[model samples]
Target: MRSDRDQVGRRIVLAEDGVLLREGLTGLLHRFGHQVVAAVGDTDALQQAVAEHGPDMVITDVRMPPGYTDEGLRAALSVRRVRPGLAVLVLSQYVEQTYAARLLESDGAGLGYLLKDRIGDIEEFAAAVRQVAAGATVVDPEVIRQLLRRRRESSPLERLSPREREVLALMAQGRSNSAIAEALAVSEAAVTKHIGNLFTKLDLPPADTDHRRVLAVLAYLRGG
Candidate 1:
C-alpha cells in the first residue's frame, strides 16, 4: 500500500543460519519487489556482505553462526555504527528482552524485530518491510510480551492499577486506539485518555502515537 514508487526495489542483505529459511525468505523478498543483493548464513558473512554490497536493508536472524548467542545483534550494531540509515529486520524464534533493549538503546529508526512464526502472513509481513523501509520501528507482539513481563518486576508498573497494566500490555502488543478500545470494552476516546495518562506518568516524549507507544514500552522494560 505504501510502496515507494521511486524506490520500489531497495537493495537488501539477509543473514540467517537456517539454509532453507534463508533461501525461502530471499525468494519472498524478491517476489515483494526488492533486490536480494546477498544472503549469508553467519555474522562474518553478514559483515562481508555489508562491506561489499552496502544494502539498504539487512534482514538477519537474531541467532547466527560463530557463537550464535547474540551475533546477529552484534552485527546489527556494527552496521548501525557504519551506516545509521540502514534498515534492519531481525527474526527470532524466541523473545529476548535484552536483545530488544540493546537494539533500541541508541537508535530505533528503520528497524524491525519479528518472530519466525509471523512469516506465514506473507502480505502483512511484507507490509512490515515497507514500514521499516519508511523509517518506522516494527516490533513483534511477542517481543512486546517479553518487555511487559520484564516490566512487572519493577516499581512504577507495580504501582499501576490492574486496568492500567492491561492497557499498557495491549499497547505494547502494537494495538491501535480502536483495537485496544474494543478489547477493553471502552470507547476510542477512553483509550486515548488512558494513553495520555500512561505517557505522562512514564515521562515519554509526546510524538506520533505509534512511536510514543514504543518508547513507553521500551521505558517500562528498561525500568527508566
Candidate 2:
C-alpha cells in the first residue's frame, strides 16, 4: 500500500462549485506536493482547464454550477472521451450508482468515485488520488457495499459462496490476487482458485488479459 506521501508531485486539475471546499482541496493537494494546474467551478471551465493543462489527474465534485444534477460527472466522461487515459476522481455527497456505472462502463482504468465525507481522512483521500493517477481503479468501499446489499436478493451474486463473495469484493476494490490473499489470510493459490470460480460462476469467459476479472466485478456491482 502506497502512502499519500509516496505519491507526490502529480499535476492535477480540480473542479468544485463551493469556494471554501475548492480552496481547501487546493491547499491540501499543494501540501501533499501535487500541483493544481487549474481549479474551476463549472463544467465548461473544467473542460477548458483539462484541455489546456492536461493534468495527470482530475478531481471534481459530482454537482457543479449552472445545473447541479450530474454535470460534473458528465463533464468527466467527456474529458475521458477526449483524452482517453486521463485519470478522473469524482467526489459526491451521495452515491449515485448510475453515475458510477457510467464511469466504470468506460475503459475502467484510471478512475475513482468516492463520497465527499471521505475527505476527512486526508491520508486515504490522497492515496486514492495517487492510485487513480497510476491507472488503477478505486471505487469507494461504501459504494460496493451498497450495491451488494441492494442486489443481494435477486442478483447472480447470490450464487456465490460466502468466501467467493469476499474474494469478489476485494477484486472490486482493485486488489491483485496476492494482495487479496494477504488480506484474507489465505494462500495466493487459494485466491487464484476463488477468482477462477468467481469468473466461471459469473459466466465470464477467460481472456489473456485480467480484464475478465474486472468484468466479473462489474457484473457483481451491476447486480447481475
Candidate 3:
C-alpha cells in the first residue's frame, strides 16, 4: 500500500484485448493513484496511445490483434526500439521465455514479464507497476523457474552451486543485493559473494558495473 508520503503516480497506457480485464486494470491502477491515460484493445491502438500519451509506462498483454499470436509483444519491442528508455511490463497468460528473452535483450531496467493469471495480489501488482516505472526489472517467479529448468547440462549455469543459483534467480528478478539477502535470510555480504561467484562461474569478465547484472541475466536467459 502506498501512502501520501512516498506516493509516485505514473501515467500509464494499458493494452489488453479483453475488455473486462482492460477496464478492471484501469480502475485498479486508478485506485492506487496511477493515471491510465489510455486503455487500448490492440497493438495498433496501443502504439497510437503511446505516441499520443507518452506515458510513464506501458502495460500490455502478450496476444492481441487480428493474429492474436505475439503482435502485442512484437509491437512492444518495436515501440521500445523507437522510444529507447520507455518502460514496458508484459502480461501474458503463459510463460513464454523466448519472447521474454528477446524483450530482455535490450537494457533490462524498466522491464517486466508477468503471467496474467498468476498475479493474485492487487497490491503486489501495483507495486510491480511502480517498480518498473521507476526503472526496475520485475520478472514473474514462474518464468524464472521454467527459465532455469531450460538450462542444458552442458551450459555454464550447470557450474552454479544450488545457493548460487538461488542468488542468480533472485538477481534475474531484479532484486537488489540487500533485497536478495533479506529474501534468503543471509547477510548482504553473503549475497555479494554469491553474485561474484556466479559472475566468475558464468565467465562474465569485468565490465560496466551498472550493466554487469543485466549481462549475467542475459547469460541465464541464453541457457548458459
Off by over 4 Å in 1: 1-7, 156-224
Q: lDDT per prediction?
A: 0.84, 0.88, 0.87
Q: Which pairs of residues collide in model 1?
A: none
Tens digits of per-residue lDDT for model 3 on 118-191? 55688789888888888889898988888767745548889999999899888889999999999999999999
* Model with the higher lDDT, candidate 2 or 3: 2
TM-score against truth, every candidate: 0.68, 0.67, 0.66
Compare the candidates by lDDT and give the number of the best one: 2
Among all windows of ten consecutive residues in candidate 1, which has the lowest summed lDDT? 1-10
Error of 1 at 62 (Å): 0.6
Writing each residue's lDDT as its tens digit, candidate 1 over 15-122 gives: 998989989999999998899999899998999999999888898999887788989988988987899889988888888788887887757599888888899899
Candidate 2 overall lDDT versus native? 0.88
The C-alpha local distance difference test score for the whole of candidate 3 amounts to 0.87
**TM-score of model 1 relative to the true fold?**
0.68
Task: State the lDDT of candidate 2 residue by residue for 1-224, as single tens digits.
Answer: 76654466789999999999999999999998899999999999999999999888899999887979899999999998889999999998998887877788887599999999999999998888888888899999998887767667556687789999999999889999999999999999999999888888887887854888878878878863
- Candidate 2 Cα errors over 4 Å, as ranges: 1-8, 154-224
Better of 1 and 2 by lDDT: 2
